[model samples]
Target: MPFTIGESVLFFGIISLTTIVIRFLPFILFPENKKTPGYIAYLGRVLPYTIIGMLVIYCLKDISFTASPFGLPELISAAVIIVLHLWKNHTFLSIGAGTIMYMLLVQFIF
Candidate 1:
């Protein structure tokens, strides 16, 4: 079966509208406030570490121990970032340095 342009536009519009609504509806419904719930506050505190762990795990998921290089630079960069974060408690600087280090390592060494 052949699809028409009008049908395609309608489908795309509906999808775009649905996506926008789903993405922003929660914010519109429940606006942010200074006083958040206890559980939410706890979750907010833990979520960054959880997200970082997930991201690190995801980056290392396909690494093979026997493979040459084997994403060692990424592992080292992550460790460096962790250390810097622990020592200085600067999120943006740690991430920026880690990313730059990783890119340089990849470009020069690997």
Candidate 2:
């Protein structure tokens, strides 16, 4: 079907507004209290691990089992970050080092 520019703008505007309202309505209407309930506190504690796990799984979902040099740099960088974080307990250093290593590896090796 042919769509005019005006119609496309209006359609997108309506969708954008609807999505914004739906996403933010709860936060706007019901402000959180300082003392959250037990269930919510438990959820807040668990949510970070859940989100990180989901993100890691999402990133690795497309990885091929067969060895490929293209994926080695990322794997090595991630391992460096993990090892540094585990051993040294330095979040920023781990991330910064891993990122620099990844950049260098990508620029030189790949």
Candidate 3:
């Protein structure tokens, strides 16, 4: 189906307005002159670790110990991530290295 010119213009206008509203809403809600709420500050501090924990559980939820590969690739990749993070203290290096290791294991070794 094709939109008429008026319909396209209306659609784009709504999208542009929505984008502007979203961009400015944060500053409107939490102006620089006012102090942020305690609960919001606490969530900002806590959500990152909570999200990381949730992601770890999500990533490890499907391993099969009795299967052909026996979850070795996943376990090895996780260990690599842990070791790299501990040794170098770099989140991106550990995660990127672990992802590459998992892909290599699945494609060529497993």
Q: Judging by TM-score against the true structure, name the best candidate.
A: 2
Best-performing candidate as measured by lDDT:
3
Worst 10 residues of 2 by lDDT: 26-35
lDDT of 2 at 27: 70
Local accuracy of candidate 2 as per-residue lDDT tens digits, 45-64: 89988998899879777766
lDDT of each: 0.85, 0.85, 0.92
Candidate 3: list runs displaced more than 4 Å.
1-48
Q: TM-score for every candidate vs. truth?
A: 0.54, 0.62, 0.54
Candidate closer to the true structure by TM-score (higher is better), 1 or 2: 2
Which segments of candidate 2 are over 4 A away from where they belong?
A: 1-8, 11-15, 25-45, 60-62
Worst 10 residues of 3 by lDDT: 36-45
- lDDT tens per residue, model 3, 1-110: 38999999999999999999999997899888999899877886999989999998798889888888888999999999999999999989999999999999999999
What is candidate 2's TM-score against the reference? 0.62
